[model samples]
Each structure stands twice: as C-alpha cells, then as structure tokens.
Target: MIAYSVTVPKEYGYVILAATSTFFLNFWHGTRVGLFRRAAEIPYPHPYATAEQISSASPDKKQAMYLFNCAQRAHGNYLENHPSMVIAMLVSGLQYPRTAAVLGAAWAVFRIIYAVGYTRADKQEGKGRLAGSGFWLAQLAAFGLAGWVGVQMIMGQA
Candidate 1:
C-alpha cells in the first residue's frame, strides 16, 4: 500500500468550490435543454437548427414552443457566458480568490433564477434577467480587481 498527501493553497479553496458549482450549474442547464428537446421530439441537429425552423416545427402549440425556446435559451446563454466566467474565475482566483468565489457562486444562482423566470414567462426582461445581468457585472468587477491586484503585485505594491 502507498499513501500520498496533497495540499492546496487556502486562497484556492473557495475558488475551487465556486468553479465546481458553476460547472454543475452549466451542466444542469444543458441537461434540462436536452430533456426539453427530447420531449419535443426535436432531433439533435435540429435542436441546433435555426430559430425559424424550431418554431415552425412546433407551430400551433404555444406552450410547446415556449418550452423549446426556454431550453434553447438556457443552453445558449450558458455557452455564451461560461467561457468568460471560467477565464475571470481563473484569473481572479490567483489573486482575489474569495471575491472570485462569491461572484462565481452568485453568477450560478442568478443564472438559475434567470432560467426559471424565462421558462415560466417565455420572455426576457424581468427580475431574473436583471439579476443575471447584475451577476455578470459582478464577475467583470472581480476580473478587473484581479487584474489590478496582479499589476500591483508585479509593481511590488500588493
């Protein structure tokens, strides 16, 4: 038998937690979109098809179309925002781990709220949408703070 020990910097603890949570949230949204697509009998490639096509396929069924739209938007929003979140979290973690973690967690929570609101209303522009925007702004702030800290560190001021 062999034993090994591993260590992580304290600052990174929250960062890891935040990142993991965000990843799971993204996965959940993706899976939800998949379920919607399956329920609608929309083919794989078709799910990724044009909006016109998707709407046309489910014409005369407002609720079904709304469900599909919600799922597609959820997945699309995740894909669009996740990359920036990853980069911001990584950079911020190196310097402002706690801030990064808090913002990252907030982002995930806001995204869920946004999804629920969008699904229920079948439209954007609401409290959930506002929260999502706010969270994204918070993330950008975290990234900016991290950049500032990095610069300060390089200048021997941090």
Candidate 2:
C-alpha cells in the first residue's frame, strides 16, 4: 500500500470542533424528529402548511419534523463549508487559532440554540424564526473567519 499522510494541520482542531458540534446538533434534531413522529401518529398541523390549515391539518407534526430535518441540513452545510475553509487555510499556510475559535464557538452555540428552539414545538413562531436567523448569522461568521484566514495565508503573512 502507498504511504499516505493522515496528519491534519493544527488549525484543524477547530474544524474538528465545528464538525463534532454539527454531529451533536444533528443528534438533538434527530431526537426531535423521533418525538414528532410519535406525535404525528395522532395527526398534527404541518409547520409549512397555511396558518388556517394548521388548525385543521392534524396538529403540526410535519412542521415539527421539518425543523428537525432542516436543522440537520444546516449542520450538513456547516460541515461542507468548513472543510473548504480549512483546506484553503492549509494551502495558503495561514492559521489563526483565536479567530477560528471565536467563529467555531459562536456557530456551535447558535446551531444548538436553533435546534432546541425548533424542537421545543411550543415556542412562538416569531421566536423560532429569530433563533434560526441567529444560527444562520453565526454560520456566516464562520465563513467570514475562514475567508480571512485564507486571505492572510495567501498573502504570505499567515
């Protein structure tokens, strides 16, 4: 077998944290889906359904399920986007631990909160939207941090 280097750059620790956080978030969301499925057997209003229809649409299991699935998808997005940033940093040779840590922490917390808010199933719709938006914003921050790292690395100041 050909020798392969399995070493990850030091900066990759934060990337690992981000990835692990995504997994936890997904796990929580999956639990939400399980709860929703159980409740769904009795019929519930779908979150995506019309407001008026929600009252008559079986009590909203579908919507609850949607939040769980969507949160998982959001984590998938984080996983996808984070690696490119890590690779870019590695290639450019720029590693900023402080920046990465901040971004990763924010993203992780936002994602966790968003998942919980979504799964709660009793929060006001407005609150859920706000929480979810915060999660997205955190993701955007991670992207920005990664881009900055990549840029600094490319500039040879990394």
Candidate 3:
C-alpha cells in the first residue's frame, strides 16, 4: 500500500476566491434574465420574442423584451468565455499564483462592467467594448502564463 499527501499552496486560496466571484457573477446574470423574462411576460421555452410579436407589442412590453434580450445576451456572452478563462486561471496559478489570482479577480470585475453596461438603456456597445477589452487582456495574460507553465513543466524546468 502506498499513501500520498497533497498540500495546496496558500496562495491558491486566493485563486479559489477569485473563481468564486465568477460563479456569483453568473448567478446574478441568470437572475436578471429570469426577472426580465417575468417582466416581459415571456413563458418558459420561449427564448426570445418573434419579430412579429415585438412589432405588435405595447411600449412597455417592447421595453421588457428589449431588456430581456439584453439580459439573455449578457448571460450567453459570459458563458462563451468563462470556461476557458477559468481553466487558464487555474493552470496559470501553478506557476504564478498571485498573478493568476489578480487576473482572475480583475476578469470578474471586467465582466461585471460588461454585464451592467450591456443591460443599460443607452450605448451598451461602448461600455461592453471597453470593459470587455479589459477581460480580453486578462484572458490573454492568463493564457500566456498558463502556456509558459505548461512548457516549463514539459521541459522539467518548473
């Protein structure tokens, strides 16, 4: 029989905290979509209102639909990039724990900015682009860090 002990570094705890932020953000976004769905009077299994439906909707209904679509898109966009960023953050933590944690936290903040901006009444695109750029930069840094760590491990240098 063989026994092994694994001890995670204390710094990785910060990474875990950062990872938690993303889940909270996801929950918030999903909740907004649900709330908007209710406001729009949209039933389940109906992803979005049809063009004809929107055309015939009252002003308030139209606004609700607009908001609902915005919420849905925000959640969808977050889903698109979240998995890769999380993986990179964890992998980068192997070699650069503090840096990975910083990037992960910053990524969550950027996502917050993007989500809020995207759900706004005016100029969602500008805000999304700005904050989204920060997240993109964070993602690129995490990916580069992870790649370096992977290569170092392969070369037996890490």
Candidate 4:
C-alpha cells in the first residue's frame, strides 16, 4: 500500500489559523440567526416575553431577522469562498499566521456584539446597520492582511 504524502506550504499553518477564526465568527453569526429565527417563530414574544418587548419591536424586526438569516447564508458563502482566497495567497507564497488569526478573532467578536445590538434594538432605533458596518470593517481588515501577505509572496519577500 502506498501512502500519499500531503505537502503543506509554509503558509498552510497561517491559513489554518485563519480558518479557526473564521469558524468562530461563523458560529457566532449562526447562533444569532438561529435566535432570531426562533424568536420569529414564536407567537410574537411568545409566552414568557413581556408586552413592552413586543410593543417596542419595530416592524423592521422582521427585516432584521431576515438579515440575520442572510448573515448565516453569507457565512456559508465565506466558508466556501475563503478557502480559495487563502489558497490563492498560499500559492503566492504569502502567509501571515498572526494577522489571519487576529483578524479572524476580531471579526468573530465584532459580529457577536453586532448581532446583539442589531437584534435587541428597538424598531424605532435600529442599530443593525451600525453592527453591519463594524463587521464590514473587520472583514476589510482580514482581506487587507491577506492582500499584504500575497504581495509580499509575489515580491519574493515572504
């Protein structure tokens, strides 16, 4: 029997670290989406929920819930797409493990806070957009780091 040897690039370790961060962030986002969905399925605040809670809810809550669902879907897209992105960087010989890990962790943290602020906010006072922006910034940072690493690899600086 011949055993196949999988060759991991020098950047493979960094990519794996980044993948860890992505996993955490996705889990956080998935939880929020699940909570929102569960809330929606309930009888408008359900049994234990207060009337104030129900009354204060904006009609846009539905939209917010939908957005959470979208985020969950987006998470899947990232899972599928991010590996290729990382692979591209790796192929370019660019790998920054610390940057990838940190960005991933930051993104995960931001998304959790964002989801809380987004879903629990009063309808008249929506904070989902702000939360969305924070997550966007985190994502941008991750991509930027990836780009920097790629450039270094291409320039033979990696």
Collision pairs in model 4: none
| lDDT tens digits by residue: candidate 1, 24-115 | 88888878887767666667676544566555764535455557666687668778888888778877776677888888888788778777
Q: Evaluated with TM-score, which candidate comes out highest?
A: 3
Candidate 2, position 73, lDDT = 48
Q: What does candidate 4's lDDT look like per residue over 1-158, in tens digits?
A: 43434345565566566656656666766666566657544353332334454456676665544444444444554466555444533343235555555555565566566555555445334445365446556566666776776576557566
Better-scoring candidate (lDDT), 1 or 3: 3
Which ranking of candidates, highest lDDT first? 3, 1, 4, 2
Q: lDDT score, residue 61, model 4?
A: 61
Cα lDDT tens digits, model 2, 1-158, are 33433344677666556556655765765565556555543334433334443455544555644444444444454456545544433333235554555555675676666556654546644255347456456556556766775566557545
TM value for model 2: 0.57
Strongest candidate by lDDT? 3
Better of 1 and 2 by lDDT: 1
Better of 2 and 4 by TM-score: 2
Clash total of candidate 3: 0
Clashes within 3 Å, all models in order = 0, 8, 0, 0
Off by over 4 Å in 1: 1-8, 48-60, 122-128
Tell me the tens digit of each residue's lDDT in model 3 across 22-52.
Answer: 9999999888889989998888899876677
**TM-score of model 3 relative to the true fold?**
0.88
For each candidate in turn, the TM-score is: 0.77, 0.57, 0.88, 0.52
